[model samples]
Target chain A: MHTAGVTLQQVAQQAGVSLATASRVLHGSGSRTVGEELRRRVEAAAQELRYVSNAPAQALARATSDVVGLIVHDVADPYFGAIAAGAMRAAREQRLMVMIAATFREPGLELEYLRSLRAQRARAVILAGSGTADADATARLAEEIAGFEADGGRVVCVGERGPDLDTVVMANRGGGGLAARGLWDLGHRRIGVVSGPAELLTVRHRLDGARRALRSLGAPLAPDAVTVGDFTREGGRVAAVRLLRARPDLTAVLVLNDVMAAGALAGLRDDLGLAVPDRVSVVGFDDVPFAADLRPALSTVRLPLEAAGEAAVRLLLEPSGDEPRRVALAAELVLRDSTATTVG
Target chain B: MHTAGVTLQQVAQQAGVSLATASRVLHGSGSRTVGEELRRRVEAAAQELRYVSNAPAQALARATSDVVGLIVHDVADPYFGAIAAGAMRAAREQRLMVMIAATFREPGLELEYLRSLRAQRARAVILAGSGTADADATARLAEEIAGFEADGGRVVCVGERGPDLDTVVMANRGGGGLAARGLWDLGHRRIGVVSGPAELLTVRHRLDGARRALRSLGAPLAPDAVTVGDFTREGGRVAAVRLLRARPDLTAVLVLNDVMAAGALAGLRDDLGLAVPDRVSVVGFDDVPFAADLRPALSTVRLPLEAAGEAAVRLLLEPSGDEPRRVALAAELVLRDSTATTVG
Candidate 1:
């Protein structure tokens, strides 16, 4: 700060402005209360004088608890890790520390993390909904956020939305529909679906989109067309095994996430002796780094997870709740070598 | 805590012991204060009453932020996430919050995190060294730890140890030596080394073992035998390209980590058109989860990363001296499909 060689008083003198005006302009936090013309004049003076803010004061004022909390199902999965990186970047920008806890897809852990976040007095909690078999998770998400709010805690739910809570989510349903439509357009009549935790809102929404897409193509999905998994590789294998067995004639599958896609790929090629794309086209969600590197590069949806994390931070720090509404960001499809036109 | 259904006071009174002993037994903090006979009585009563400790009293006594600070390179890396999980379990046992920060391998951001830890008044700061290129990051690490201590902060470092601080690290060199021995015993010669950042202690140790193994075998390793990469998939690709191009006659390649191993697999199979185990054998470090799932399972060394993280937490919680002794955890080499009897 001293290295700037120009002080606030110098800026005030340079612009023929008052010391208070210069202080307000040079320091952004206080500038909000200053008049526009006076603020501009003070800023011009500071620019002319090459003035710098005091590091000690700036740091002290900006220094928060430095703790941001992330609630997730499993930290071991690469998809969660990718989202965590985004949250980390956001925390770094806000000069905040991050604490991540794995619920292991347990609703109990989700509640435990929320309570701990309250006790630690974290700046915000980003909840990636639990991957589980319970149908009430989405219905309960609002109540969960409400309880946290009652305890004077801030909640930012990613991939889920609830009343009175800040939510940053990807447009998952649209992405799912897009994936289904992409395959449907390729003349595939029998398309199978692999889904995440049956109870999760994302899983439900994605299934809805897939079913809708099938309906649009004049071919409604069968009751047994979709099989649910717990979002782990093992789960993917189990789901794929059953799906393939039930419908050996199925030509394409849209797996819930890329990790599951990897599992599906291995299960098909190695376990079942089926060739990718040629026999069964496989597509996945969440274009994790390894997706492109997989043997027949996986086709997947790239969720802007980092941006969602950043948006959550922005929302938490500058909450504009006069008319708070949920924001839905889009997830784009990234096509690679995973999908090939199917032939009967 | 409320759901325990048994009260500490009742358990103490029933066991004919004082409240402190029962509390200590229940909390598992401050070693067993009750004597053998008395401890037995307390345990018997506690079991009879199914007693549990409330969070309030513990929060009051150890209330001034019982948080263990963790700063790592990437949350997306499965190894670090495993480490974080282990550390969190330890923290939960001790009833503490684990504050985390991801540095993205930026020293400037790391400094900011270190300062943030101090400002937040964390109980201990645990730094998990992330990248390999940081040879002297420890020197810089020491300065930050010193500054935190000067500000009355406690720091415990994992993975990387230094002259000035308390540390918990895995035996990288020993593990590396064993890996080389594994390959040697398997009759593989003319081995190639693909290591992490050459400046890292782990990389240096692994490289030394490879050299020693080759030299002791009475085989002079060609200078062209060693290649250094950034411990990334892309880095592996680039390094593999150069090494394979230079030495088409090489029999095997040793990779520093599993992520890089997957990349080396791609480069050999897809880019370089070489058959694994037949043309060149590949081995990696960390034995991450995905290693076993890859087409040809990876051969790797398993390091107890989680234990290291927990050990660091332990050291940080307790005031240890400046002796700076290394805690050498045991590691084993896991052999799988990636290596064969050097079929020529």
Candidate 2:
């Protein structure tokens, strides 16, 4: 029999043995007692046929491994770090080991890790990052995840929803609107925005929400008021500099993430020689660990990052029905010293 | 043939086969083939006497896996996060996947992870944090690592040296001295120190260095001037508060780490209502990513954390003789706005 199309049933048939006996012999499970002669015949048939079972069948044959896989865009980023920490804590409680892989924001790498985790026979796999803007990458990921699930692997996402997978999503749009409203309430009419990559769903949702808030306040944000950069600190710095140069009249600058906000703070002070709140107020999203410790202390939106991670793991570990599980978390606007009443 | 104490040579002799043929048949290496009858005889003899192979022997029999293991103290800590990022980057370039496990500062967990990695047959294992204070933990780690190495697996340590393993040592003591001297040069004599867990080698090295600096300057650190905490932000806050309450006459405070320094700054401002520099200067070690952006901009000792991580991976990947490799990195003192000359 050709190995490419060989099956366990065919091997069992050739060996003149039952499927269970064949499986027990092939999987090296010693619990069943098969006569030496019969076991040898089954093994010989399997070797001749070169049978290869799918991941699920192979997993069932072996002792189930107690390892869970976690994939993040960047583990060094405090945002993802906080989430991974929570997942690690939960895994420890359940006596499960976590094997984390960093994709570094590359969608291709994410898919590669999923395949690797499947090969490792991990009990579950959690992808923790923003959904990519690449349609092909997204489609491939969806297909891969579907195949993985079919093979008895559980998967959960901790950031934006991806192709109907179980997800714990943050309220990016609402948080953006809340941030804008908070700045507007501080008497800041003229504001600028430091946005992340245009292709990212996070940037789009947040920007849309900010625009909605501006419209509701009867002071819509202009096209010229927005500058985009990578969702990173250096990107934030460059965008902030561009924003200051483009519109010096802006009283406050809203950053999409806390890491970027830190960069903007540096840009305002080092590059523009501008005083925070006095010259240009600053606000950020995602109240990361260091946000409260920043010099002026950041005024931002707080997301339950750790809790989101724990929830994602819980969704994976719990039994699921047909419908994909969805858990949406709310973001709260936290007022700090980074924003102040507009100076006349 | 009795499987116990039955070496492969003895099995080959009993089966009337060459040692090479016995190995090829036993390992199931398809490159070379033997007669079906001969293979059956070898199999029967092996099954009649159960034999167990070492990890390397089992690994060699199977296709080599493409995964490297990284063990960290905590993924949530920025210091470890930065190192993990660098290692992840390097692993990507090599087309090898990284499997990260966080011990959460538990030595027993660290040992458990080592065993897990060995079971996975990882290409290499990197332990990326401080060694435990427990002597037994250290001894067990050394034994495990030695066994792993004996089984043809490579191991590297990234923070403090663990046993005689290859290590990338940070200049914790020298950095501590640098931080203290920086404060001393600023005309502050009466100083207080916020230390991490006293049992940690890092804490001991840094504190000893700071004491050395104080003594060299003809001003010894008073026994009452030191307060120990968990090497965390909250611990820093509590330690800072205790230090201030105990040593009200102090003019400057040196925190062992930047994360803790951020807490000390908060404590000085919120708990004591004291003006930084004018009332009490502050300095710290390990200029993490947010150090330069902290409100007053942290004055700290900058360790090349990412570079250290990269170096650790390089050491593991590169071939070395029986002698262990050692790489020591320097720390630079960064003077920022947080520290100033004390007022009369």
TM for every model, in the order presented, reads 0.79, 0.81
lDDT of 1 by residue, A30-143 (tens): 426878888788888776654544332332244323356888777667777877888888777666667887776667767766766655545568886534446575446555
Question: Model 2 RMSD to the real structure?
Answer: 11.5
The stretch of ten residues in a row with the least summed lDDT in candidate 2 chain A is A54-63
Stretches off by above 4 angstroms in model 1 are A1-66, A130-144, A147-153, B1-63, B130-137, B147-154, B163-165, B314-326
DockQ of each: 0.17, 0.18
User: What lDDT, from 0 to 1, does candidate 1 have?
Assistant: 0.73
Q: Candidate 2 on A97-204: residue-level lDDT in tens?
A: 788888888788899888767656577889887886788888888877766675566889887756477888889999999999999988999988999998777788
lDDT of 1 by residue, B182-202 (tens): 887787877888877876666
Q: Provide the interface RMSD of candidate 2 in angstroms, 1 decimal place.
A: 13.1
lDDT digits (tens) for residues B1-344 of candidate 2: 01123456767788889888778788764888889999998887776643322222333344245667899988989999999998888887886768788898888898888877765657789998887577877888887787667546788988775646788888988998988888888888898899999877888888888999999999999999999977889899889989999999998999998899989889888998888867888888888898888878888889888888788788877875677788999989998888998653
